[model samples]
Target: MLPGTLRAALAALVPLVALAVVPPAAAAPAPEPVAPSAAPVAPAAPVTWTMQPSSAEGPDGRVSLRHVLDPGASVADHVTVANLGEAPATFLVHVGDGTVSPAGDFDVLPVDEGPRDGGAWVTLGDVEGAERLGPGSLRVSVPAASAVTVPLTIAVPADARPGDHPAGVVAELVDAGPSRVRFAARVGVRVHLRVAGEVTARLVADDVRARWQPSWNPFSPGTVRVTYALVNSGDVRLGARGTVSASGPFGAGATHRDADRREVLPGGSAQEVVDLPAWPLLRTGVRVHVAPTVVGEDAVDARLEATAVEVTAWTPPWSQLALLALVAALLVAVRALRRRAARRVQARIDAAVVAATTPPARPAPPASSPPAPRPSSPPAAPRPDVVPRVTEP
Candidate 1:
């Protein structure tokens, strides 16, 4: 029999030896799960606002402000500005001198610059916290999703020139926060104030020129580019439509192209260019015709005259001429060669005829023959009977 303590120790060693001999079954590592890529987030939408001509009551159905008043006359009008954003915004309301841009769009002077013409004659009504920026300029604040109606007055100067003094009332949105790059959005309505006076509708064409672009292919026609400036020297704003025509000398190969209609403010000029297909005539004549018409819905009572300008361009057919010259030179060379060949043939024929007609010298006799003595001229004649008797003897 074993002791109790020794038996218990043996039992513990047996379990430890079994555990060391055979460890727990090893587990295989699981694959790492892949996470999906995050989707791109869209940027927030920008805020927007609007402005238009209005009345004290509300926004009337007017697209722009138009008035025909005498010099020194004053007119009252209104403009409405609406804030469409969720937050309240401050706006700078000002009047600016209106002018037609080079792109033919109506534009106003910058807010920083002061207006001198019709814009200078305008004044804004007093509002709380309304700070005067300059002549005819003020700053006002509007509540979120609300509209502000502002009163304005246009008092034309006594010595203002007769004709159209174009201007506009602009509302520029103030930026909410400070930024490295500053940008302000602006909206406006045009103010067309025509001072009552003698109105003239005239358009002048200046610096008219034409250039010819020759084609590389000898058989195809070239293009003629015509350029000119259309000046509105009259008191009224005018639109014009013109035609560009090109023709060769003596009015041959005439081609006509129509120019698109364009509007020009008083004292403003627009540069126009047109291209037309033209034959490569030695000399080409280009004509530009500009006819003046009323701009927009204005009913002007004046004669709108048409202006025409003509210019000449040299469009030489260099490729065709070169090809023709090459052909001519080839023909000349062939003709020269033919003439030389004919001469050679003629020379050969002449030599053959001379050889055939020329008599050969008589060949020398093979043997020399003895010559008989010459008889006197008197003994030459003999009767027939005597000659026979002598022969018989």
Candidate 2:
């Protein structure tokens, strides 16, 4: 009660402690709610696709890629569509460049036939829906779990450039409703416009360094592997027979497998494979030789010169075996002949018993002992006479 100043200080401290204990519940600073912006959703990017066609048409399950178009075509063409997608997606292919006409975006434009050397357009349908596709072409659409191919045909302009023209074809892969896989195929189209006016025959050589299939050989019976290259120089396809000759101890022999016949397009190269019998030939150590025409009609008007090939022939392991067999057989025959001769001598000895056992014959002894028998009879008479004489004495 005496310390008034201490009471004032204590009162101030009491208020401070009360404030620390009870003041915290006052509207807990309006809890800041999380701003919805933390989980912002993103927009989806667009889906694009490309188409790759094959050299030929194929059935379902197989990807048909073949698509032909004119270089100067300006028509609206369609291509057979194939479904290679896992889900349903809308597909449209279109042609650009001069192939597109004034008819519309994917309209029909009258153009000349054949290629103009300058590349042209061939739309499947459109990205969404395109027009003015190339000639001899079409578009295709594949359904979810199904497939369909549509025809695509167009025309080429009469006045176009010459040589080769190139273009790019696109196949858009999409998921209409957003599905698992998105497949797109693209084709790189090349238009060869009759090579300007015309080009002469050309010659190309490949696999020039000749090599044997086995790379080695023996004269024994076996096959000689040979491979060569064939290039068509003329404007037309060339199908002719050519030969590769081998010279060895056997003889000079050659064979031609397939001669790029029937379909060797100009400026195209084909591989030639031949299987030659390693039997006896004109010489030993296979040598290189060529004979262009063996037998058959020349596919092209131009005559062909035989292409030479490097060859190798191995020694005949089989000949060695044959010689060895002959020697062994001769040895066995000689031994058998000697044994037979010895057997004959022994058999002759066994058959001749008389010559071995009989003593040598001698002349008769005559009557050397014949006289003894007569003397014995005289003794009886002599005895009688002797008895009479003893009585008288």
Q: What tens-digit string does per-residue lDDT give for candidate 1 at 1-393?
A: 899999999998998899899978989899899999899886544657888899997789899999999988999999998888877788999999998877788998987778878888888887666687765888889888988888899898888888988899999987766577767679999999999988888987889999889997888999998888888889888888888899998999999998755678888898887889998989999888888878888878889889898889999998899889999999999999999999999999999999999999899879977999897676666666774435554
lDDT of 2 by residue, 1-393 (tens): 659999889988998898888855555577788866676666554433334333225233323222233445443323333444454455544333223212211112222233332334333433223333454233344554553434333344555332223333334343454567654334323222232333333344346333333222343445565565666554433344554555455354444343333334454556656566554432334333433331222232344555544545553445546667889999999999999999998888877876788888898788665555655454444555465545564
For model 2 the TM-score comes to 0.36
Clashes of each: 0, 70
User: Cα lDDT of all candidates, in order?
Assistant: 0.87, 0.43
| Candidate 2, residue 289: how far the Cα is off, in Å | 10
Give me the displacement of residue 342 in model 2, in angstroms.
8.5
The weakest ten consecutive residues by lDDT in model 2 span 101-110
Cα deviation of 152, candidate 1, in Å: 1.0
